[model samples]
Target: MNVKLKLPFVGEFGGTWAPQRAEAEAAWELYVELATRITYVELRPGEGLVREALTSVYSLFGTTRDILRRYGPAVSPADRAGELTFGTLALTVLNLSLRPMLARWHPRLLAWEDRRPDDVSKMDHENAWDQIGELRAKLEEARLGLVQLADVLAKVAGAAPLVVDPRLLSNPEKERGGG
Candidate 1:
């Protein structure tokens, strides 16, 4: 079935995402998370690192993994035939970009916690850590990968490139449609 989508500033566009458009729309939601919520921070060694920051990265891994598993198979044969399609790009990001970073860091972070001294608080241990820079670099790489994936997905879906306004992030109410 042909699905018509009305996008802001882009006019009307149509695409058939096989069984239903909802699957494609569901996959596109990851673009929102990658564009808005996932931010890059300098996680330098010997600098204080908040638990929440690392937690967010872990969440990123989970979110991306879940999306890949859910939507990777939904890619249409037409999209898969192309050399540079959303499905291929998403798989590349998940397997080549994110998986390695997660594979290395997840265990390392756990080990660091395991080695934490009895008297030292988790916060204090994190503050005294000296391996944060590597993690930061990996995160930055993943961020770039995710952004690239989002851009490709946008093109595939005929959506405008995401240009997040700082105001919208701060005041969600301002973005709500007024009655």
Candidate 2:
């Protein structure tokens, strides 16, 4: 998409434009990451959520909830059960009832979305370092949660997962005649 040639000022530089921003591409990459992890966790539903993953997201959302409580009235109450913070959504998505299905988290939805006319571009990045830090922590928590869900599944299982066959472990859909 870039038509401009990089006239290097004094060092190496290149003009580039892509269909998606790096963050957007990373967001799509998360789909691949989620798919892989989902397949692994499918074999072990009896295993519970990892404490760190649970606590990490809980803390992140909990803190964010506290912060967003001030702006709660700005976001639509219908989209979310409670506050609209990312942590709250994450926890809701992973509630015990939803444990059988693999859940993924989006970092962008971690904060309050204020549609109030006066709130546009109102985000004070310089004053929001703490919130940014929490977002980073949330990202790490998500990475660990996705990567470690299966490991934690394997480790925390009180008994062997009721896998039909050892071969089916890698492709459980076969056992269900879906593979």
Candidate 3:
């Protein structure tokens, strides 16, 4: 994945770019933490408060998006061989999967939070949410996408991910009936 490039004052620099590696490592670390947190958050279901769930997920999504922004540019040149770049893939995951879910849910959840009864505990309010089941399903989808993205980031960085999702062990394209 190494690519040669010309620097402003340094002439031709070769091998893996230092900035790219740094960004990749940083992005990888963030992805791992986010993926793990999302999984844990999803596992217990209605045990946590609605605000806690919404804010945590909202924060993670924003952070992940920011890391990908930096990481994508750094490694972009290394992946310009007409192959699908990690930048493109990361963008796809964010736009196609996470964005829509978060767009619809964040505002909806906030509205729900606004209407919470004065007497209701946070947990009780969350548990009573009519869309808890739907939210849980969206969380599962988002978690899977994050895990797959984390695996790809690990591959790019040549590091061992703490959590390797089983679904990603298989060829995802083939699983989806693509070559």
Q: By summed lDDT, which 10 consecutive residues of candidate 2 come out lowest?
A: 5-14
lDDT of 2 at 134: 46
CA error at residue 114 for candidate 3, angstroms: 1.0
Worst 10 residues of 3 by lDDT: 5-14
Local accuracy of candidate 2 as per-residue lDDT tens digits, 1-179: 22121111112112332222322232233223343442223222223323323344444334334433543433223443443322232233345313322133223323333322455433443123344344344434344444333222222222233323345456667768996
Residue-level error in angstroms, candidate 2, position 79: 37
Residue pairs clashing in model 3 are: none
Candidate 2, TM-score vs. the true structure?
0.22
- By TM-score, the candidates rank as 3, 1, 2
Runs with alpha carbons beyond 4 Å of true place in candidate 1:
1-27, 40-79, 118-121, 158-179
Task: Give the clashing pairs for model 2.
Answer: none
lDDT of 2 at 36: 41
Q: Which candidate do you rate higher for lDDT, 1 or 2?
A: 1
lDDT of 2: 0.33
Candidate 1 per-residue C-alpha lDDT over 11-121 given as tens digits, one digit per residue, 9 for 90 to 100: 343344343353456456766666665344333544445445556655765776676566655643454454433454445555555556667777787788888989998
